[model samples]
Target: MNTRKRQLAMTALGVATLAITAVGTQGAPPAPPWFTWTTVVNNGDFMPTDSCVPTAPSTPPCRTFNSYNQPSVNANQVVVIRARSRGGQGGQAVHGVYTRDMAAAGPVVRILDRSTLVPQPNNLDSTFIEPPSFPRIDIGMDTVATRGNHQPVWRYFLDDVTETRAGTTGVYTNPFGDLIAGASKLGAVPDFSFFEVPEAPGTPFDVFPGAPAVTDGATIAFKGNYPVNGVGKTGVYYRDLENAPIPLSADNLEPAGGSNPVVLIANSLDTFIPGTRTIFGSTAPPSAANRQMVFAGFDNEDKPTLGGIYLAPLNGTTQPPLRTLVAIGGQVPGENSKARFNRLGEGVSFDGRFVAFWGAWGTEKKTLVLQCRTEGNADRVAFCNQQHPNGFITTVPVNQGIFVHDLGTRQTQVVAKTPADYDDFVYWNFSGRTPGTGEGDDDGELARWRSASFVAVSGLVDGTLTDATFHAAFKARTGILMSGTYAEPVDGIYLREGPGKASLLTLVETDMDGSLIDPEAVDDLGAALPVTEMGIERDGFRGNSLVINASMGTEETGWAGIYLTEVPE
Candidate 1:
């Protein structure tokens, strides 16, 4: 198994032990509450279907499917992508994208529905096409996207199963669950799209599943496998959500032997689409702003060069100037001799000026920095030093931590580092496990703030880490929502403002008393709030509003639901 997979396995094992006895040893005053909880869409609710009325169209009635996956929000509305059963017809489950105000009266309106979209062959190639329905939507399959300028709008890219013939069934499917060809697709190009989301039922757009389009006058920074000489080619493409899509990274665009662009996203919360709002702060204004996008790409062959992150304007022809932000190998400027970003981290500032991600450095590199314990091995001299004898052991101040790059300054700074002392270990919850959902699996993604000043990262960080310096640096920051792990006395969600203090907000599940206990209300940091299984996944921010998916019962008897917790400014 790869390093990340191994760490997750270890995390799962740690969780097993903690579930038996999650009791806080010492007591402290309750920290102030930072967020107010609200339920956006739960599994039990019936989503509206066949709601739109196209000027000239007749689509089938909508179907309902449980399970809410993606949650995105803007100043106006919160949108979620939900799947519906095909009623057992056979092919795949259909999906719909809906928006709401958190308190809309009737059934939430679904903007895009499977019955409304029909896959057609990409005119350029007879075989290549888009996924015909929502059952084919897979965000974890490297299909990441963003709205044009992070505005609430239509989707720019999406994927689904391919049709058999130009309009038939029986297309080839892959392990990733995407249809490859239209009965006769040639080459390895996967079924994908770069079109707009259909505005009304029966008004089909060419692209596959994508984030909402750039309705708010934003640009689109999306990734897809477009056809090159009839063969599938992967690259980062930019569009203003107006004209055609432009390739930022593609074959022949990079120097000889260079690899394709592998863009980083804020998190694995949804398909790699830009949501309506940018989480990190940006100086770039709305006017003429959708012209550029930031991404990571490698132009060097042979050495696997950790690659360099690049930015390009949407106006450029051929390939824009490939500005290298930070590269791992080669004589590249800003190259970190000790570490390279394997898979780029997520969350870019609005202006495309700043980017935040986790990095791999020395032998101490980790997919989840929370795994780097600091207690007995507080110095990290044991495992960390063993991993990088020449790097962190001798030179680097901190081995692996979160870092941010300023496109304007061309500089990278460590936002937070693994504690050098065991007493200062950061805590994250690993108890929110969902078998097929890939929930607890994504333990430590970078949670960035809209101001770009502070970031809320996951892992098992407890209340003890709070100190004078921690508070001063993080006090002004919000959006730190992490799962409570076995490392703590309880397994619940914890909220903190800045780094001064953390409050045990609620448990993954209610306690034995059958009540969702509030630790703050009880004035006890380790108060045993009652609840049953309620582990949360994809807990993140849409601007300052937080969205998460939680399962109410164990996998056998529980159901998953989507929630919205508004952060108080």
Candidate 2:
């Protein structure tokens, strides 16, 4: 997933319901080929606020459903950021919120309806910097919270809300009742103070960098930078939505018990903020009886040490138990600089036992594959070393490798890549020379393996054989669903059932008739461009769905729209 998509998935926070047209499950056996494509929301059917400039004269001034939207989902519903007002010629677009029920039958519902007012010049000083009078809503992760009576709660960040440092003359009074040091109104709500800038002598940090994760129990845990009053301290703070925001890795909770917080470990540095977290438990309607959180902290603050992933319990305690499942500096030579956890995001087993993540070992002719225990608070770095003293299962020319750490055994296993397969696979555009080539620079690397043993690796790579032959062989051996122009059609999303051939997952061109909106209601209703980007939900109704952002001919042709799809169970 890209940075923007990752942020959308992580930042989503809210609870709203919409009408859904119930599509019956496949009557035949549940398997591949049983997949069905249903349109959640297309243009025309999706209504923007009245403020948007309308394309037709008889129609009210409005904008079409924006293509730049990001979507989030739970077992029962899907939410997205829909733009209502289109900026005419050189104007700015206005946005609104929308949702759809996965179980009911109806059109997409607009919870925060858009305004009908004409586009106005932006007042940068106002809560909303743009023309829309509504707050700019950025949706993040969504969860089915039982605490709120099984309601669907979605996480979101609102821009344009007032955070006045000084009271106004009836124009604005602090809605939060209390005030923080900074006067910025860009943060989450129902708990807005969590992102405010504190006064001097306190850690005046910005909003949570990474997004928050919500559990089925209505508990939310996020990466936040908080400053304590009278204490000059700063670090990523972990807060649960059930109570007041408290620092799980605060300065007081560190080994020194002051400004130097432990950062979710026995003795870790304070530079480990801006980390990613994953909350795991039983299937849908996750049970809190055995829920847990796994995360990786980075030394972004430039501490003299390398960062590692940590695990903690969410048993409703003020300070739940925490430990260093994996730390820096091990048996591997120069591991401090060579090996690093897949920091893109966190991934945990359904039962919250084993956690899987990729470890990049740099350009060296080796892939560092390691794991640690998540079942206990014991230090497992020694155990991990004992299992693989060389710091990896095998050495291969490939830099990207997957590893799974068994929490129970406290042992790590290399799931992908081995010395035996060295030079067996080459990245896309491989000239059969140079170690790392062809889109090798990892930025938004997304490697997700579903409930099955197979995984979909982004980017194209060939082996000693043709691209098709290489992909087939690789999938047979590693269960990796990989494809490219040499093996499949170009400019489209495709899914493969390992051990066989790849199948197209999406279309590069389609008419507007498939859209949920009326035929005459929209102009240039056809969708163009191919699947430019895609992200498979790692958990939470992810087994059957995936998200993609697509575009038409160009920006003038209405450039983007985010869509969600479901496959056979």
Candidate 3:
């Protein structure tokens, strides 16, 4: 075999291998073996007016479905998400407005038609966007109830849709509701529909429905936690769609209020914010100490005596709650040189200890990985920490702006960065190394397990728009789906396929690179499923690269919605 002939033969073989297709479950189109794509939601056609994106008469039957897209046609999983900026001083987003998204796998996409109360975008000065969910979904929306213009305000919608005290309900994809925070809830309508969480549950601060997955086919899984103070507020939680109004007044869930009485904790409007969260130690509950690090507060206003790492043991069935933990960002005179801190976007991990956050304190322009030692009242100081661990083949900020931090590493890698002036996002994955248990100790028995890996990360840049951007300017995202296959953000959808793996997947787009309408469309189409924005877990729908596009005047009608495609391999 001559050199040229050998090369030609190998090339042909590769092409042939790429062409092989496998039929997904229940008669889906034949796509590449072990690889499938699907559409979960497509509300792009809905009119932009009305509190809920008007469910205009459409050919695709809008069936009522679960927002937390669960179930899998095969090994792969997915979710479609949409959102519009709040158009206020800061570009804050209100999510979880739509009902269920269209789901596609292989060549088959299923869209559920239901009377969903989608939120109406202000359309004033915001960008409506729809992205795909990989390991889990992160969606929430808000609604405002005002008596005319000058009247008193009533209810407020986070996603700008659900009618408070009226027809407002959260749907989840997980089958059995959880015992922790009400991250999972049944829909107001559609008897059995479940709503996926829109915000990321920051562990060590709070725990909600997270790590969404389908086990044993019909069994859906999400994270659950126990609240500390009666007002300590339980973390991002899940309400078993099957077990609404769960009778969980135990120390495990809500820590009974009175002498072992359950505390009635309320979740905040920002419950579903995306970022990294940690799981409490295996030994929690029963003990009154801080059982977990489900939630943490961000105090950038002023530097305090104790860094903003809140820690207050729960009083006996009698005492009130203790002080909260905090870490100030910026210089604090004679304080430690760590300076002030800034929390990257919000999200979480399974165990609820170690966290990945970004900060811009004096002098240091970098990221940090803060860790907690114990769970519950025993939540001592951070024991293990890994700051801004990157998994790129080249020397780059592996995973910048840490969003969702997990204990076990996966096959995710950071690919590329976006150019200036472009809309860019970042993506993270659990790029499993050949030897999963190395890096720290040789015994492979170091403190439970080795929670370290060379993460595969990527970012996209635009061809136009050249502006200097600090590393903090970009953000990260992730989503979940039925099959459990997580889709971490990559450079573009066109990137070649690797072996399927990951618990969560999300796309992180960078901000402002000259022009990036085409790639954004491509990435959008590739990352999203037919159904979007309503699942407990999300994946792959992430990356940090961005392409700037021509501004759409406020004349727009519809709010931003995530869209995607599943091309034939």
Models ranked on lDDT: 1, 2, 3
- Better model by lDDT: candidate 1 vs candidate 2: 1
Scored against the true structure, residue 76 in model 3 reaches a CA lDDT of 25
Candidate 2 per-residue lDDT over residues 420-534, each given as its tens digit: 2222222211011112221111111221111112122211122111121111111111112232112221222333221122222222112212222212222354432322222
Q: What is the per-residue lDDT of model 1 for residues 426-543, given as tens digits with 9 covering 90 to 100?
A: 2232222223331111111221111112222222122221221111011011122233112322223333333222221222322222212222212134334433333221213333
TM-score of 1: 0.46
* Estimated TM-score for each candidate: 0.46, 0.46, 0.31
Q: What range of 10 consecutive residues in model 3 has the weakest lDDT sum? A: 141-150
RMSD values for the candidates in order, in angstroms, are 16.1, 17.6, 19.9
Would you list the C-alpha lDDT of every candidate in the order shown? Answer: 0.31, 0.30, 0.23
Cα distance off (Å), candidate 1, residue 482? 22
Which tens-of-lDDT digit does each residue in 274-372 have in candidate 3? 222322121111101113232333322122222233222222221123232223342322235653334322232211222223322233222322223
Best by lDDT: 1
How many angstroms is residue 561 displaced in model 2 relative to the true structure, after the best TM-score fit?
Answer: 3.2
